[model samples]
Target: MSPVRMYTTQVCPYCLRAKALLKQRGVAAIEEIRVDQDPKQRDAMIALTGRRTVPQIFIGETHVGGCDDLVALDQRGGLAPLLAG
Candidate 1:
């Protein structure tokens, strides 16, 4: 599986959902960056993604955007292939 990373906050349900999906897809480890606790990281996230939201996810070096985007990719049968890489 590709390396999974996520920028998340403490109380985001979407973040939890996104993580659960990744786990279900057999992602054994996730490099979770807690942006809520660190302003510098949050700023970096915003700069990289151009979005000020929790649950900014990435698989390998590909930015996967947010929870809804993740779900949509799975629905379109793209998630597994991305994970496989």
Candidate 2:
């Protein structure tokens, strides 16, 4: 599976959902950057993804976006193939 990275907050339900979906899709490890804990990281996340939201996700350098985006990708049968790379 491709490495998963997520910009997340501690109490964000979307972050939790995104993580759960990645886990269910056979992602064993996730590099979680806690943007909420570090104010600088939130700025970094915005700079990197152009989004100021928790649960900004990446799968192997490909930006998978947020929780709803992830779910839509999975439903479209794109998630597994992306992770496989």
Candidate 3:
């Protein structure tokens, strides 16, 4: 499986939902970067994803975006293939 990484905060519902979905999809591990504890990381997340959202997710090198985007990708049959890589 591709490496899964997510920029998240402590109290983000979207982040939790995203994690649950990824776990259901058989993602065993997730590298979670907490932006709430570190201001620099939040800035880095914005620079990387061009958004100030809580859950900026990355499946390997490809940015999978936030919770809604991830759900859309799965609904469209793209998440499985991407995760396989």
Candidate 4:
């Protein structure tokens, strides 16, 4: 599987949920970027994803959006393949 990367904040429940779901799907390691720790990282996230969301997920190079988007991808059988790549 490719690397899993996420832009997250300390108190975001959605970030926790997204991490859990990814873990459940066998993602052993996640390169978590804590935007809460650094104000500029949040700006980088928005610049990269065009969204001001807590959990901006990326499976390899694919921008998977937030928690709901991750769940939807799994439901539609796209998550695994994306991860596999």
Each model's TM-score?
0.98, 0.97, 0.98, 0.97
Please, what are the lDDT tens digits per residue for candidate 1 over residues 4-56? 99999989999999999999999999999999799999999999999999899
lDDT of 4 by residue, 1-85 (tens): 9999999988999999999999999999999999989989999999999999889999999999999999999999999999999
lDDT of each: 0.96, 0.94, 0.97, 0.95
lDDT (10s digit) by residue, model 3, range 14-63:
99999999999999999999999999999999999999987999999999
Ranking by lDDT: 3, 1, 4, 2
Top candidate (TM-score): 3
Worst 10 residues of 4 by lDDT: 53-62
Candidate 2, TM-score vs. the true structure? 0.97
Residue 5 CA error for candidate 3 (Å)? Answer: 0.3
Question: Model 4 — TM-score against the truth?
Answer: 0.97
Better of 1 and 4 by lDDT: 1
Runs in model 4 deviating more than 4 A are none
